[model samples]
Target: MEIYETQEENAWIFRIDGRLDSNTAPELETTVFRAIENGARRMVIDFEALAYISSAGLRVILKTAKDLKRLDGKLVLCAMQDYVREVFEISGFDTFLPIAPTAGDALRQVAPPKE
Candidate 1:
């Protein structure tokens, strides 16, 4: 998977493309964790081009969200395909993590101060 990150105002955006499986989950995790560690409180993860995700991928997302919450941070996911969204819903992630219809919506959902 490829991660293209950018900043918009105070929000950090990570646009991921390709598969997010056991092989590349760690790389993505490290990138995201580092971003959060670097004080990215409001993050919008774009999943429009992502084609797949494994259990490892799901774990990374969950852990990130938990960590963000501890820091009073926010994590938003946008433009997910139906297959991926189904996995998130079935895994109970949809309830814990916020999902917006678009990247703009995700960005707007971020709370102030930290963002």
Candidate 2:
């Protein structure tokens, strides 16, 4: 998968393209972990271009979520296709991880409230 990362304010956004399976999951895991280690707190994963996701991908997401939680950070996922959305639903990931309709929505969810 192609992972593109950008920053908006304090939030880090990752846009995934193609498929995420066992082979590609590690790449994503490493990259996101690096971001977190570098002190990234707010994260948004945009799955608009993602074609497929395997259990390994789910594992990476779950791990990242847990890590962020331990750091007192937050994560949001957005722009998922129908199949991907179904996968999260069937796996019950949607219940815990915030899934937004768009990247903008996700960014908003991760953003700190204005004064």
Top candidate when judged by TM-score against the true structure:
2
| Per-model CA lDDT versus the true structure | 0.89, 0.95
Query: Candidate 1, 100: how far from true, in Å?
Result: 0.3
> Model 2 over residues 1-115: C-alpha lDDT tens digits?
7999998896999999999999999999999999998899899999999999989999999999999999989999999999999999999999999999999899989987789
Native-vs-model 1 lDDT? 0.89
Q: Could you tell me every candidate's TM-score relative to the true structure?
A: 0.93, 0.97
Off by over 4 Å in 2: none
- For model 1, how does the per-residue alpha-carbon lDDT over 2-86 read when each residue is reduced to its tens digit? 9999999868999999999999999989998899878898888999999998789999988888888899888999999999999
Q: What does candidate 2 score in Cα RMSD to the true structure?
A: 0.8
List the lowest-lDDT window of 10 residues for candidate 1.
Answer: 106-115
Most lDDT-accurate candidate: 2
